[model samples]
Target: MAVSSYMTDAIKIDVWSDIACPWCYIGKRNLETGLAEVAGDADAPRVEVTYHSYELSPDTPVDFEGDQTEYLVQHKGISREQALEMAARVTDVARDAGLDYHFDNLKHTNTVKAHELVHFAKEKGLQGSMKERLLSAHFVEGRHVGRIDDLVELAVEIGLDADEAREALISEKYVEAVRADEEQARAYGINGVPFFVIDGKYGISGAQPPAAFSQIARQVWAEHQGEPAAV
Candidate 1:
């Protein structure tokens, strides 16, 4: 088999998601699992994943007064009972993906500052780590992601400079970068997440299964090699 230059180069994956999004975390796990599966192949190309900003609830207050259920009830226009049922279903799905979601403890807030922190981490080559930390903190630890102080603490936990991160968030240094991502998401016709643009061509929406991710990767790899994808 002849290996093309594309096979050797890394595949670029741009993911648009929000810290407050449960499905985004699950999709992240699935994407990682799928990439790992493909990586076991000797001829597989490496993937470079970059997460972008997408606020599920941009108008959400930094300090929301109610619980996840109440927020859902008010925002989603569902009853409290329905909100609980929805949370339970999402919790189960997240647990299956190895995520410990605590809706009861979740503090729903605007994620713009968190997104800015991510961009700061990206500048430091720690975007993935920062994103994971922010998600885990928000969903599992019930941490406040919308505040500069809280985000700075999380940044330090990931080995980022506390002072630098604080300044970045305070000055909204990466606000435009975050906005640019949102703009691009709009341009791509993505109204929801976790939306993925793989290798700048393939688009995958929602929290797809791990197999779905691996299959797409393999198909893309095959196409790069000018070969028909294996069914």
Candidate 2:
């Protein structure tokens, strides 16, 4: 008898998101749940995930105050009651996904530089950690992610060299990479965050429920199984 690995088929899901977008985080959690459920699903197929970038507000201020309710009412022109309702809805969604969002204290920063940093971090194999830290810093600690000093320090906290991180930020390395993702997002007609593309073909948008995402992913995965071999 010979031992064999569990070599099932694979599905690639490319997700486009901005850390500043609460729904993106909510979507991230939902997609993960969907993926895990699919992996163990009796009817669905397994998959892999890769995150792509999409800057929600590339022009947001660097030192802006962290009060999202105020920001929405003042900046985006949302009414106070509307802002509160929106926040409340998002809070409920996050809770469903097991997330503890600190929207009240979240620092709203221009995420362009942070997105650029992620482009570079992805090259260094630290994409996942960098993404997590950046989001947590903005959403949890109220850190100004747009500042080079703050971002570099956060990078260091997540195990990268501070000086090197600073250099990357100052030199604007990988700026084009971030721009490229933006371009791609535009090409895809993506005007929102938390968009998911399955195998470069199907597009799924919004922070939909786990069951919804799981159903789409399973459908795509099954289709992938029967495609004719590339010549």
Candidate 3:
């Protein structure tokens, strides 16, 4: 990760992720676990988690057919066997994080629009729930985040105004914020989801165990006191 500017006080965590990515979902849970352990109250650390956009399959076709096996082999240059193996590996990882991943039913639609929806969610002060909903829609409920009507339906189910959500999706509003997030990821040399930057100075990458994130959160807290590093 590129060096983010400095900070002396509360941590500012900006997570770059794609809702379609299973690891991103687990990463969110793991990071939250860590954050909870490190804080005094349940919401301790008083985190302000801003979700940034990173499309895993930006050029993915608007509509795709068949199992993910064929999709991966054809689009990602991986063989069917390799793709299945990869899915199994990711499934195991998600399971370790206490999630049930059903890749078989997963409809891998282009997530650029979903990312756009998240940006709009941010403006609506519903980014957190919207992110959670989007992830569940894709990973658990098998909703098609790539389709405007489906996405609008899910957005409304999550308490967002349905009409507004549909309008924004169709009008492509708040796309610049999504693009800015992607650009920031590129500028920071981020190539994967679940990348976390805490306190603007302390950096962490990948969906590490919650203990790791808790340790870093405490460490950042210690830095504020100029005390020895917290274990």
Candidate 4:
């Protein structure tokens, strides 16, 4: 965690994550829970959340030749038993966050195009929807996120113009945006997924519990108001 910049007014949270990252999805759910907890407080700052790009497995093939277990066993250099154990551990964590993680059905593929679609959706004011859809498509429904047709169809499902999304992906329109986000992540010393930067001041890493994020939100709100720190 490193200090970036600041704003004493409304709160802004920028998240750097990837669609293929399970912990990122859990982190998202926990963040929403945190926001809900703070929403009841009249003194809480207005919060705006933005998602950025971070590819956890950039080297994964567009059409991955194996399943998640095999990929983990190969890419992570773990035994088959270890890969299954890791998946089970993450599955339980995701379940706690209300995510039905079907790792067996998950399609492990390159997420560059999916990240590009997120940027494209951001331009259309639907980045959040796109992010959720992409995550669920990969983790829950086992959709192939690397393919253009599947991504375009998912974009259309979220009310985005299919033609525009297709064209953007074809032309690599948002590749620079994705790269810029990665550069910012690197500069922030964020080497992990599900990193949250709050108000450009506080950095929270990993899929922490809702209480952890809520506590920070309360503290940030109190600080901005020049009041004693909230308990």
Misplaced by over 4 Å in model 2 are: 1-9, 41-46, 227-231
Off by over 4 Å in 3: 1-9, 40-44
Tens-place lDDT per residue, model 4, 1-231, is: 122233346678999999989999999999999889988887655788999999988999999988888999888999999999999999999999999999989988999999999999999999999999999889989888999999999999999998999999999989999999999999999999999999898999999999988888888877766678856
Alpha-carbon TM-score of each model against the true structure = 0.96, 0.86, 0.90, 0.95
The deviation in Å at residue 78 for candidate 2 is 1.8
Candidate scoring better on lDDT of 3 and 4 = 4
- In terms of lDDT, the poorest run of 10 residues in model 2 is 1-10
Backbone clash total for model 2 is: 0
Model 2 root-mean-square deviation: 4.8
Candidate rank order under TM-score: 1, 4, 3, 2
* Worst 10-residue lDDT window, candidate 1: 1-10
For all candidates in order, the CA lDDT equals 0.93, 0.79, 0.82, 0.91
Error of 3 at 188 (Å): 0.8
How do all the candidates rank in terms of lDDT, highest first?
1, 4, 3, 2
Error of 4 at 181 (Å): 0.4
Per-residue CA lDDT of model 1 for 25-134, tens digit only, reads: 99999999999899999788567899999998999999999999999998999999999999999999999989999988899898999999999999999999999999
**Model 1 clashing-pair count:** 0
lDDT of 3 by residue, 1-231 (tens): 122222345667889899878889999988888887777644345457888899888877778787778877987798888999998998898888788888888888888889889888888899999999888888877778899998898888878998999899889887888898889888888988789878666567888898888877766666654667734
lDDT of 2 by residue, 109-137 (tens): 88888887787788788987888788778
